[model samples]
Target chain A: MSVTSTTSQPNYHILSVLVQNRSGVLARVAGLFARRGYNIFSLAVAPTEDDALSRITIVVDVESTPLEQIVKQLFKLIEVVKISELDPRRSVERELLLATVRATCDDRGQVVELANIFEGKILAVGADAITVSLDGHPDKLDDFEELLRGYGIVELQRTGRVALPKLDREARLRAVKGKVV
Target chain B: MKMTGAQALIKALEMEGTEVMFGLPGGCILPAYDPLLDSSIRHILVRHEQGAGHMAEGYAHVTGRPGVAMVTSGPAATNMVTPLCDAYMDSIPMVCITGQVPTSAIGTDAFQECDTVGITRSVTKHNELVMSAQDLPLAIRQAFHIATTGRPGPTLIDIPKDVLQNSMEWHWPTDAEVIDSLPGYRPTMKGHPRMIKEAARLILESERPILYVGGGVLKARAAEALLELAELTNIHVVTTLMARGAFPDSHPLCLGMPGMHGTASAITAMQQSDLLVALGARFDDRITGKVSSFAQQAKIIHVDIDPAEQGKVRRPDVPIVGDCRLVIEEIVKAIRELLATGSTQADTSVWKSRISGWREQFPLSYEPSEPGEALKPQFCLEALRDSAPPDTILVSGVGQHQMWSSQYWRFDKPYTWVNSGGLGTMGFSVPAAIGAKVGRPEATVWAIDGDGCFQMTAQELVTASTERIPVKVAILNNSYLGMVRQWQEMFYEERYSEVYLSPDTPDFVKWAEAMGCVGIRVDSPEEVQPAIDRANSIDDRPVVVDFRVAASEKVFPMVPAGFGNDDLLLPPSQMARKEFLR
Candidate 1:
């Protein structure tokens, strides 16, 4: 089946969910996503940027309906208190952070120049190498990293994903209202 | 309240809730054996130590509990190595207890001192040489905890003679302390639903997706859940050697076993798929062939119970570690949601067409009429699978039959196919099946052995018959050592030496009957089924079906040694059909 997208590139998606912290629960959820062949962009889970619940923000490449189903399943877990898509259209701001370099002395200057243009900092420096770090939308960081790789690359590391919804209080009240209705 | 080390061990095992054990007594372990005599534990005195080891594996596989095997130190303990290696490779949970030379006499080259712990480290999940009475309880408790947790495997506790006699307070911990302390014991559950949904989207969007099922499905008892996901998504299923019959091989969507000697359809389909979802099975070298060309086109999603398995081989696009059953159930839920929202469907017609062509082109072939001259190994494996109970546990010794059994047996449940998959130890099945039969007396068990292998552990037959364990023994009695012979035939130009037994072979039938067991010899091809039926008829005595199969017969659908799946050799007859089908 065709993806039916007129765009030349593949579609990408991002989602946030609240889950109950329990043994074997993470395995179940991650296993589910994996079994279906979904490629995860980034996944971060920690005590909420807000409530007592655990907030799990995941970036994936897919359409809308599957994301909703995932949230519904998350809600079914007794420990999970809430889940949301964290719409990028209305959210404040989020970024993907990466550290990578072409570990060679000759191309080190070129790598540093690109990192500076991306509003990134050089995290490490060596006689034959340099490490640059950047935080931004995943697409932007990926583009910057790709540009660096043209030089003989040496190492790479990434903080897969993190997100905070902009509609903090209003979204909570609306979620409560939706639950009641 | 002070207790001896032997007493502490007994108390610890009792605390871990051991109800029964299989063992034999010997001089090195006289002190521990003395305590065992009076303990409430019901010890089945197997005729041989090796029998005790395999009986323990059998029991564990059936009961889903760790089976205990107790034996004296030195040679007795070493005798159990084959069985322990079998459980290690197949991931069965068991506790093998060996009594050693007294601690005071250790490292002095004392009589019956064989370094049981050192010898078994690689063959077990964890092993301990308990030196002090105080450490006895903790060590035994740890052995049980480690043996039954995660991807369960055998564990050993070697009790030195002096330590078994040393005094210490006997206190059974109400809670299993070692279980609480296990650092790597955490099992994963469901992943983020959002990720699962996206995976569902990937499944729906892909034109060619393959489902690579593994032993995790059987371990999690997730067969039904996996089948549901496969049917909904319309993806084909291929299993690893350890994961035979996770989905019924007879089903249309099933692609059969994939790897060296796997169905041509399955391997070709895997090579062509763009997205391969691997569940439970680790990508072993045998399964992956040449890593560079294996699943080169497929974006993989790996779901497994062990985290270390996730990126250890070929990296996965999505690495989800958890129980296979729960993971699959959640995937099905996500797919249902996608369908409601009008997501795309998988067009698997091209994949199926290509696989069907491969199947017809080189269908699993065994010479039907080659007579006593060409008794293919597959015929024997197929006969055993067809004749045994659907739920019968088929334990195999290492070599040609081990791989062939993996290729042929349609196993649908856990514990059904027990072989030393990674170790490839010969003389494993006979003892392992004995352990399995002891573990689950209700289930049928068969030790599918080769003549060369059965002789290694044949002493266990006396134990089986004495214990009233009616384990059927089907010997593929090809006079030559089959796998080694195949190498000689293909690579060494039939320069046969050492691979063949001397002209006069021992009478296996009379030997079994001598041990108070039933024995049947099949001299002709027509007697195969009847002998199997007769062997199945025995209730209290073990039966041996020694099929005098052709000595020159070789296992085919061959993947020449040290090569990947692409270089598989079809029998000259079948190679011609590849062009005809095209």
Candidate 2:
């Protein structure tokens, strides 16, 4: 995959690293980022279908050093098997965000209507607060969170971004058009 | 069949072809020591854990094998931090096995227990704590594999006490099994043909090109291939400090070393070159001086095994990631094709004359000693070079002595010059010299050390004397931390802060004698050659010769810290102009 041309302003980039599912591998990867003074905007890690391997998705804001250097350093980790830089433009990105917001009698209806508009579900409703969950693109989740803050968010949690490359044009057209053969 | 974890560890080391290890035993490592009694591998008991680590580094530097060191938990493991960092900086292949407390007692702060893996994680290429007896073999195997492959560095395996004592069923696995298991470690051995061709094109088209070789050339055993390319292209070559022996110094096109204290000719040539063909050499701060200005005119073609090092410092116009030997071979082949088709002809007569002019104008020289005056350190080094065998391996500690030795000694072959280049580690010479001697038993080994650095690890001579390693140490006893003193003289307005190593403080001759070594002291200029000859003749035990050289002498053609190579200062006699700037 190609790294996009560097712009004057710093931009966030996502790196998906596949590594051995063993103790201290995550720490080693994180330690490398910390030692190199690279800022990690968000980090998500979990095991893959193969029990022996794990996938770590890290979003870093590039400031000084090139993304090529960061990827090379990640490859230096003995546990890291493969690293793929997911271009935001070419990949489908999603994040799961959960928020507990104050929803008293007056604001309950407004909050519910906003949640419904964002395709969010109410997980639990309490006397003072209601817990709402939404799964969508990172920017969509950010927009939903901004609306929820109007009702006074008591707590907020976000499962960083996970990405998968978009299908080829033929497959996308077939899937979108709902055509067999 | 069943075997104890310690026995399995020993068996695994044997399977990896480990013939020797340097270590010091303590309470936690005692279990591993017991199994060593029946093992075939020779263990050299070092005075300190640090000594053990450096000795292993020395051995690894000479032979392209991963040197092994074993130390106990806590303080013993802590002592290995210096050498671990040293090995990491230089990318030396080494495996350090540290003993740990029982697995159950790992977090409880048991006696002589510490976070071995945590402590070494940043410094080592990789580290593992073996929590189970069954995992010991695989961990040991993985450690060796990781330590020796791709840009090689030190790896540590911490075996808990109980893990070593516990017994388990064991079977020796074939090489294929080990190979299949390590999926994450695949080192690219072949260069991309396109990149190789592009590099060759750059080399052929450039008017002023220089082959900037580094330690990776020696690591990849690509010296012959590199020399062939240099000769074919009719280009001058500069070997970095870590790459002293990578190219023969006697070659007509060879520009000795280029960097902080590099030869003026080499530095100037690099600064003036239009293209820099950097093979396996990182543009280290010491070599580059000021990053932005270093080789500003040169278009770089960097070929290294580690992709991380490609753009880590200076960006290369053509970056090829592969083994040095393979890449050089491909480049040579591509050049041959180009020559066959008459695509390009490398005619660098103008560049050659400019470099030769610099070589003649600023030759490496020292001030002659006045009648009956104290001997100069450079004179002692020159004498040693003349007296010693052609194959003698010269290892040195960091300081003025290291720079002087690198400047004066004419290394004819690869693997003959060993020193701590990246880390600038003091006290590295004595133990490293012993290790080099151990690795190359037929070749005479000498540790040319400074007085201040010699004092730091002089006790390792006991191990050398007792073990009959027969490595000679020549101490340039200038009564000061000479390199620092020189810097202080030049930059710090001659404020010599704590740099003076007093003459009467634990006399080196008496100390060497106490350590059961042949101690010889040379005071005058006349005694330098005789002392080196006498020391060279002794083969039964290690020798320490204290040469009281002139303290005021300084290494010249120095690019002060943060200065460009073009701004090098020549010696007073060689300086026609005060400040020589490009």
Candidate 3:
């Protein structure tokens, strides 16, 4: 199944805001989202090779009409360099991980069997326990892990959402603070 | 020829075959930068000295070569600390060149000077401050040699500003002998062959024999030999976190990574096995659940390139050191002799069945609900993996994702998965992905970063779009510093103070677009895969998928540091079941 952008407007336009590196920069940016009642799907800060700048990737549901207004207000922050709407139409990637699973005695065999099928691993074991680890596309893992639900699952550790784009010359970083390297 | 210290430094680095140097220009290093203009080495000017240090680490990892970084003294040198410590923890080969105050002014606290030597002594494998211009060439040569050799780690050379501009005749020491004065540096290869033979005999005789592998395999570039041994012995293999992907994950006998987060079957297998051949793995606490219970029934054969690692933790029945590749080759020859003579024991089905029994006993599980109000990080990871190319190189920042990626990423090829495994460096992924993308332009690279860690070096995203490096970054953003928060929750009574991430939408989509990049935001579980697919659709221009995930989520099956693997903390769901089901 492919991700097809639908005519029905996306509930939220995924936005990544590039801002200057400064203390409380996240607070100011997050403040804007909070004021607008935009629930951030996920937010993280990463450094641009330029130390003075940091990129904040935020996933949130927003109505189609006022999205631009949100972008403009984000630019109002002194630390914000620019704002970009990530169109899934282009290239990107995401991933998460699961720690070991401890299946109940009765369900252990089937759980282990399912883990092998999903390319997951058995990390630890006790007289009556086991932990399995797996990483992949979330949906595929979800499908595989669903089979193991019958077995006792010890715990789940997940990374919050983090992402980046594909490469193209037009989008090549031209300058940092308008200064070319 | 007599030349300025800056010119000599450039010439020395050039001779060392350094193609790129990451650094930010500043006062003390100004003179050095002036000479850099005429050098052929490609200098990347970072915005901050810290980025340069980390970029050096990133470069070293991708290229499998020592990376060089230059900075001025004081804060510049201090700013480089995180990356230096990062390199030290990961055992990466890096050479840091920091400009110190004038040699005579060292203790005076001269303008823009700090105790570079004192500050870096603990973090670096070795630190030297060149007091004489005549020693510049020799120092550079030795630094490169030392950084890349024997348990590779970061090394630093603090050159005073006066030394950088000093004029002296350069007599490059063409051949500097290995220093013998260094303590515990010797790597021995001439171990008893009889012992190796005995080890092989143990392997053949034991009904349950397993190979415990580590990153030393990669460090030794012994993939071929490892594959050969695994195939010949028909032994199952388990890797440590640092040893992830040492053997192709697709190998049926491969048990994946083992430790606190390790698979139950692998741990049980190790416990039940009669013989365990430890390759390059140091038996860190993470892997050896409880030292006393670890491999309780097994006799271990520890093979490594470092002699010190032999008895550092669990003493080996057979300790072979020198080169992992060479030792493995020798072991193969001895084992072959045993088989040729038909003197060894036969198949190990009993042991395999025992391991199978353990595997059958415990298994990993996850919920299948489509992302809605609560978006699971696993959903995001699976989506990213499904959407990326088969050969994509996955890198990760340290924390839950780092462990999760090791467990979930399913890396079948060598070098496809890169992480700060030994060091667990938080800000490793983004810069490392950039370097990986740069080194292997045709390969797809993704950084599986945590929200807290992504923030640590998020600025590297600018490097991605600016350098036109196509590296996909999928952030598993549980707003809290998930790993630390887990520690607090489990051990510290969940007194979550600084752990909670204040919620907010930073408009990342508009930011990427503004930076002339692409961004995708997926809040619902249903949109996760679609967003990943859409992001992968574009071959050019970087994209970001910000998954709005649940907070208060803890990484499960954690064996808190210092605790044995058996001390694993079961998730709330499991705990709930135990309380309710009975």
How many steric clashes between backbone atoms does each model show? Answer: 21, 0, 99
Candidate 2: residue pairs that collide: none
Give per-residue CA lDDT, model 1, range B1-582, as digits (tens): 898887778777777889889898887667777777778887888767777877787677666788998899899999889778878777878998899998788889888889787677657766777778887877777778667766678999888888888899775553447654443244456655665766777788788899998877776778899889888887889987777757877777888888877777787778778888888888887788888778778888888767667776787887776778888888888889888888768777876787777777767666764565544566767777787876888888877777777777777665577766666777778877887777677888888888888888888888777778788888887787889998898889988768986323778889889988788987776777787777776777899878777777666666675676677667667776655332
lDDT of 2 by residue, A53-148 (tens): 999998888866689889988898888999999888888888898999999988888888998999999999999889999998888887888788
Off by over 4 Å in 1: A1-181, B1-3, B38-40, B174-176, B183-198, B370-377, B380-384, B412-414, B579-582
**lDDT, residue B478, candidate 2:** 92
Candidate 3: tens digits of C-alpha lDDT, residues A1-181: 1111221234645677777675556766776676656566556678887777787877665753356556755653434666788764453635455655665677678767777888888877666777777766444555655665556556766443345665455445544235444
Q: Report how far residue B15 has shifted in candidate 3, in Å.
A: 2.0
Model 3 regions lying over 4 Å from their true place: A1-181, B176-186, B189-192, B360-363, B492-495, B505-507, B510-517, B537-541, B560-563, B567-582
Which candidate leads in TM-score?
A: 2
Q: Sort by DockQ, best first: what order?
A: 2, 1, 3
| C-alpha RMSD over true interface residues, model 3 | 24.6
| B333-415 per-residue lDDT for model 2 (tens digits) | 99999989988766788788878888877888888899988789999998999998879999999999999999999988999
When sorted by TM-score, best at the front, the candidate numbers are 2, 1, 3
RMSD of each: 12.6, 3.1, 28.8
Worst 10 residues of 2 chain B by lDDT: B573-582
